[model samples]
Target: MEGEAGVSVPQRSRTGLRTERLLLRQWRAEDREPFFALNADPEVMEHFPATLTREESDAFAAQSEADIDRQGWGLWAVEVAEGPDAGAFAGFVGFKVPRFDAHFMPAVEIAWRLARWSWGRGFATEAAREALDFGFTHIGFGEVVSFTAVPNVRSQAVMRRLGMTHDPDDDFDHPVLPEGHRLRRHVLYRARSAA
Candidate 1:
């Protein structure tokens, strides 16, 4: 399926979603190396509490792979589909169910984390739009939400580009983080299915 600007909608296969420039597919063994690199990069992990160790990153990838195997959708490993970087592991852009309890518990979040090299090319927004489409059309989600620390303007901008709306009243401190943590206060954005 195609969306605005010729972006392909996500297919409900284990292969996962696709867009004009990305293939949001299941994680691969080869992806672990670069995935760990990105996860360990302090710049890339700036918004999060800390960089992930190799074991943490591998476990994350393993869980992502298992999720796709069982549910046919999860945090997909994003691959560059064309150009000189074709087939490169740019990073991930897909849906995740927040494990922590919050007012928004039970919501599926549209999220992305790309390599520093992939920044500024609209990859996150492009792949996320396709993932959001999949969540609405394929998974039957009435509304999908995204949240990030208050300082994460970049992600918030991507959220806006996806036509998601932010309501300050809906914002809340992340329950996963301890009180007084700098990253605990997060901004929430929501988008409802057009259907």
Candidate 2:
């Protein structure tokens, strides 16, 4: 459950499969510092619990790597394919199995986390499109889903761009979080196969 236990497709990078602007690749040991910085950013973590510590980031990165080995996909260190941060870690995008408390009808989800500096630039949408393509096409999943805190308009917008439709009725109080957590009320989005 700690690693990429439910990813059905073989993917190496969290950056993305590749678009004109981004390279979705797996995380490298060298990415730990920037990865940690992004995770520790308050604005970026605004929708989650408090920012992660460097140690927590390091441990998570290590586990992400293990997840790729186990399920062939997990969050990756994202960077521009050709830009100042092309080789640097900008953030991450990937897929994982939801914990039981996630209450997602589809059970598996495509997820992302990028630095504040990378926000509002279309990077999340682009990278996430690749993940959806991988999930629905190569991975042969019947559906793919995403979720976020009700106030996370940014991520919700990206989900819309990816053609995921909101199912407000699917919203639930996230069970894993403490009662009344500001981020506990979550909304679900879903996309089904073209086939």
Candidate 3:
């Protein structure tokens, strides 16, 4: 919720720390346009079913805000602080409460998504590692999970890079997706806090 009155972007971290090149922080209203652009990219949507419509993007952005308001934890937009695209929404990395399928119990999940332009730059791994640190250290989540379609090898690679181990037996069809959805076949990975 609103921790303080009239706070523009929420006081979670006014100017968050940097991680080499990327700046991981809270989302702003102005980020909607770039976020929508990234979400609508065909190449970026290749792993998923299809590109998200503008309306869908807007609703997703609104839901992200509502998620932070309700849970105090949600995906934070990522940007390169000193790059040409500085201040632009590169993508997001954070933890979310996902509705797990029957094969695996519900759990907190660490997720990441970067623009097509941001791919192959280690942005996803770096940001996701920080989000995992935040989730396990700061948020006190016992274990953080991530999932992707069976064919989404790139994302699975990132999860592996983040030190998550696969549990193929935990794989299941995505519950929210249609029965025959192409992206419905999913795999699970989990990383537990050392402490």
1 or 2, greater by lDDT: 1
TM-score of each predicted structure versus truth: 0.92, 0.89, 0.86
RMSD (Cα, Å) for all candidates, in order, is: 4.9, 3.1, 4.3
lDDT (Cα atoms) of all candidates against the true structure: 0.87, 0.78, 0.77
- Indicate which candidate wins on TM-score: 1
For residues 1-195, write the lDDT of model 3, one tens digit per residue.
Answer: 331111233334333435777887767888888888998888888778879888998887787666766555677778887768776678888777776456556677888888888889899999888767766665567788889999899999999999999977888888878998889989989899999
**How well does model 3 score by local distance difference test?**
0.77
Candidate 3 backbone collisions, by pair: none
lDDT of 1: 0.87
lDDT tens string, model 1, 1-195? 442212344455476677999899989899999999999999999999999999999999999888767666778999999899998999998777788888877888888999999999999999999988877876777789999999999999999999999999989998878999999999999999989
Model 1 CA lDDT for position 170: 88
Which sections of candidate 2 miss by over 4 Å?
1-16
